[model samples]
Target: MSSADDPKTARQPQPPSHAMVGTWRLVSYDVEVASTGERFPAMGERPTGYTIFSGEGRVWFMLTGDGRQPGDSDRDRAQLLETLIAYSGRYRIEGDVWVTAVDVAWNPAWVGTEQRRQFALDGDRLQVRTPWRVMPNWADKGETRSIITFERAVEG
Candidate 1:
């Protein structure tokens, strides 16, 4: 039989919504000043985090290791950051929207922060959209633009 006559290649399924539910590592992310679109000079090409999605209506995402936490004295920010990762919360999907109720965060300051993350996943590309700066801590120095994009993490 010819290659086209084989059944393997012909069995590939089209895009499916539930295909996105799984553990996905950070592929790449774009960070800019949320309100001004100002990009960080040092944020050249490094993204930090892992996201867990469950088709049964659950999500756990953690983003960390930016290397920009303030000093401990004037700002206890560094200590706080040193102790915990970005944020992880419970999430659910409705149609094409992914909403999160921040159940746990590194900093207790953000324990109650609720967020809405819009997502679109096709093949290996996964994108999440938000409208808030990454307030690293409760006493964020200021607002900083942040968005996270990821691709499928290969696993055996």
Candidate 2:
């Protein structure tokens, strides 16, 4: 008898296991922030940041500018250009959906608030899109709602 005849062998091959791990550049993404139900810019617009991802189910996000332009004082700017927003979690495929489980957050305060980023990739460009509306309580006094695109950055 062949393995194909076994019941377990009938299961479809799981999506490549190493899919979610890697230094994926933010190619493009559309995000929406919450507010007083008024129109506003999408998330990742206020400040540009890079998401450092790993295969070990880890994520670290760091920002530099506010999309305006770099200021003088290279030293001061560099000083404020980084943050260790480290987190750990697991992700896998559930039928046709890519389920993401966020278990940890850099900011302990956000430990309980979980977020899911539904995204897809093409070549070197990655596009992350969300249907849910979000609001930044810190920025704009939490008055913003929008969907934006994030483009993948070319690695040097």
Candidate 3:
């Protein structure tokens, strides 16, 4: 049987009111420090990623830093991992926030956690911001929040 015909792989119809249900291409990803009000790109000047929200209430996200290079040593591999964030699971929308009950994640700690993102849609652009918290990737930066933007992908 085809994957789309399977109950587990089939996507349920999304409600017309669910505006965020679609595929989006990453535009920019930045991190902001709560204390100093400093903001910088999370990956680099031109990070890349994609996020897909299905009518079946599933969401998948994979983002990578700009200019990622292959590593030759353990340290290099670790750095590569640090520059990536990926997760997938069921999600639900609440007001302007979307929460995902992550079933799998690049970081094991996020596997069972609910990740919440506050988002705003403007035309074909969607901007998302995470809550301020101490991030493992940039703990030394203190409480930081991710500010990401995505453009709705056009299906030609």
Candidate 4:
């Protein structure tokens, strides 16, 4: 069959929303400073996380920084919290963006917020970017955005 006639090649014109309904392994989570165009991994060079989207439109994700250790004190516990990002909620896709109406989050401030993520899917890879905002984790850096990349997790 010709390439144009192949099911995979002619399946759809727009980004498939269903393509996101699965577990994804985090590849990198970086922060880009708005003013200088400087980008760096906000969670260290080897962070770990998982983002899962249910077929029923529920989404949940938890990302933690590299080399996290059990907190031994109040200060240590606070520091641990600084390196985590987690939330869950119902979600909807609008074109290339997915907005989650967050009902729960690591930060109470995010509990009732609508988290909008601009995304692009290429084969098994997904890249997501957040709108520029001052994040409590790195508020010292001023306005910044998070750039995250994930790969579809293979099911056993």
Name the top TM-score candidate: 3
Q: Write the per-residue lDDT of candidate 3 for residues 93-113, one digit (tens) a residue.
A: 899899999999999999999
lDDT of each: 0.63, 0.47, 0.92, 0.92
- Tens digits of lDDT, candidate 2, 1-156: 788897787784443454444554432223344544444333343545566455544555443334544547887555443322345555554443444456676556656555555555555554554444434443644533323234555577
CA deviation > 4 Å runs, candidate 3: 1-17
Error of 1 at 101 (Å): 1.6
Question: For candidate 4, lDDT tens digit of each residue in 9-57?
Answer: 7874443358899999999999999988999999999999999988878
Off by over 4 Å in 1: 1-17, 34-36, 41-44, 66-85, 132-144
Ordered list by TM-score, greatest first: 3, 4, 1, 2
Q: After best superposition, candidate 2 residue 32: deviation in angstroms?
A: 4.2
| Native-to-model Cα distance after best TM-score fit, residue 82 in candidate 2, in Å | 14
Ranked by lDDT, the better of candidates 1 and 2 is 1
TM-score of 3: 0.86
Each candidate structure's TM-score, on Cα atoms with residue i matched to residue i, is: 0.61, 0.47, 0.86, 0.85
* Candidate 4 wrongly placed segments (more than 4 Å): 1-17
- Candidate 2 lDDT score relative to the true structure: 0.47
Q: Report the C-alpha displacement of residue 16, candidate 4, in angstroms.
A: 9.7
